[model samples]
Target: MPFQNTMGDYQTRQTLETFGFLPALTQEEIFDQIAYVIAQGWTPSIEHIHPSQAMNHYWPMWKLPFFGSVDLQQVVNELEACHRAYPDHHVRFTGYDNYTQSQGSAFVVFEGRR
Candidate 1:
């Protein structure tokens, strides 16, 4: 079956991917994307990576993965907390599927302060 597109009116995967590197995302934008992911029943996670070590390092999992949040605000709250802590590093929002046990989709919502 073909993939069902969600995040209506939001940027398409192709568009989002255009940012091979993280694009500048406002706090509102991040929250908007978070809201969309939560509505889809996907788990949200934050990843951090340094620009200098982009070649030698991997996207380190910063915090514990969020699974099945009952409240959308909770997920946004967690993301905000993570961003404040790592304000100068690269951070991206990734949503995972609980059933297939695979990454459902991912997007670099923000690329911390350059």
Candidate 2:
């Protein structure tokens, strides 16, 4: 029998979260995504977690979901505030759809030190 490479040896490192595997989104792009979420009537929320524990635990919500919020700038402000407070933590933005009662969209907005 000839020696052959098998799939079992492959290993992947845990990444930040959704959108983490892809190139970081630009500020404008992030804004656009938030806008879309709001347009869909999804409430926006921010969460943060230390990079080391990102995959092991649930991130704590920054404050609370911005219910009834249509101001894009307000959401951005909260995101910025969370980043400032947790400079070494990964910050994520999520949209909660009331009708579905689940997260409709989510993405990492700021990446912490790995």
Candidate 3:
């Protein structure tokens, strides 16, 4: 109900906050969103989204290894495009590091007020 209260106030924007979960996003749906980033010819990884800030934080998202098959910068560019598309929306590419190559469910983030 809390999110409903805040989210209801800005219905469409709230929808943007979601990880493309409307219309009942199945695995394919999640993959579809991920594919949006991947289609740019980069391996999309969960390098940035955070759990607390994500609607799909607790979703059944998982990560797998890419094993010498990845293009980080391309993913970065793709995500950058996504960011450009959603300027006002709160999104973060939250948690990727040297050890992990970001292979998890795509989750949007609500960033701090700039």
Candidate 4:
């Protein structure tokens, strides 16, 4: 069957792929979290999602297909939830650092940092 174009599925897959949720993750809530990820700033590194390969980590590879939006807090929540569900998936971040002085692609991530 052809894929059903639904936001719920997108949110679920994105959350699972990026955050590593197993089964208990609800489809509806993750969508909300996705919105929060972009709204809060900070981009999910390519490695954050796909850790096996770095050579094709840029774009047009493992991304592009699964590129969906999720604001910062939601990303943090999703990651934390996944960490709780699976210990090995526990990832410790360097925390949110404001590098607003940088440019290109990252300009948004560093925005508001003085």
Candidate 5:
């Protein structure tokens, strides 16, 4: 993937990228990773799309996403709810810091398995 600035435009970055995923990461692992992202002062947001109609552009999962919240548990709960709600669509959680126009991390907990 190319670098994306906060403006939803592509740009290069001097910083190293941080990201990871697994089909088998445990719930505790997810919480730990999210907690680390929250500790970085980044706000988490979710995005999902249908596997059949995948778009090149990113689509937000929430209309009004929580910004700069320090509540990791609540964020995790919201992720769980999203996973439950869209069990058949690809879903991802991404932490963004709007000020820097940079995303701290992104995780895909569900792959829309049938």
Candidate 6:
């Protein structure tokens, strides 16, 4: 017996790995999310990688996670700095939960030009 294909030639659209399905987030929304993460006592971190490699490779951290950081402006400043330094790379923000030893929240803040 031979196997039969159920669907034929269906093409899928490739999108960004994070927050791709929804509308893009504004600066204010991003700030709010960051503040929430901090209030929850989660450490925040930024990571970036070339858009082309976003799906296959792990992004490198922009700097050490802002552990015990209470200043929201400082985290925003770092995020801006990372965007300035790597304008052509996809930038992502993450909140690390110490209790779960895993990421509690994450989303792409910037999408690189294709």
Query: What would the TM-scores of all predictions be?
Result: 0.64, 0.85, 0.29, 0.25, 0.71, 0.84
Report, for every candidate in turn, its global Cα lDDT versus the true structure: 0.64, 0.85, 0.41, 0.32, 0.67, 0.83
Estimate, for each residue in 18-102, the C-alpha lDDT of model 2 and write its tens digit.
Answer: 5655556889999999999999999999999998888855789999899989999999999999999999998899999999998
Model 6 segments more than 4 A misplaced: 1-13
Question: In model 3, which range of ten residues has the least summed lDDT?
Answer: 58-67
Off by over 4 Å in 5: 1-23
Model 4, 1-114: lDDT tens per residue? Answer: 123357676564422223333343354544354444354553443112222231232322112211233445544464555445434321222222235522112101110111
Residue 12 displacement (Å), model 4? 24
**Backbone clash numbers for all candidates listed:** 0, 0, 6, 7, 0, 0
Cα error, candidate 6, residue 80 (Å): 0.6
Candidate 1 clashing pairs, residues 3+ apart or interchain: none
**Ten residues in a row with the worst lDDT in model 4?**
104-113
The TM-score, computed over Cα atoms with residue i paired to residue i, of candidate 1 is: 0.64
In model 1, the runs with Cα more than 4 Å from the true position are 1-29, 55-57
> What global local distance difference test value does model 5 have?
0.67
Runs off by more than 4 Å, candidate 3: 1-43, 46-69, 94-114
Candidate 2 Cα misplacement greater than 4 A, ranges: 1-13
RMSD to the true structure for each prediction, in A, is: 8.8, 6.9, 12.6, 16.0, 9.1, 7.9
Off by over 4 Å in 4: 1-23, 44-61, 64-114
Using TM-score, rank the candidates from best to worst: 2, 6, 5, 1, 3, 4
- Record all residue pairs in model 5 with backbone atoms less than 3 Å apart, i.e. clashing: none
Worst 10 residues of 6 by lDDT: 1-10
Candidate structures ordered by lDDT, highest first: 2, 6, 5, 1, 3, 4
- Supply the global lDDT for candidate 2: 0.85
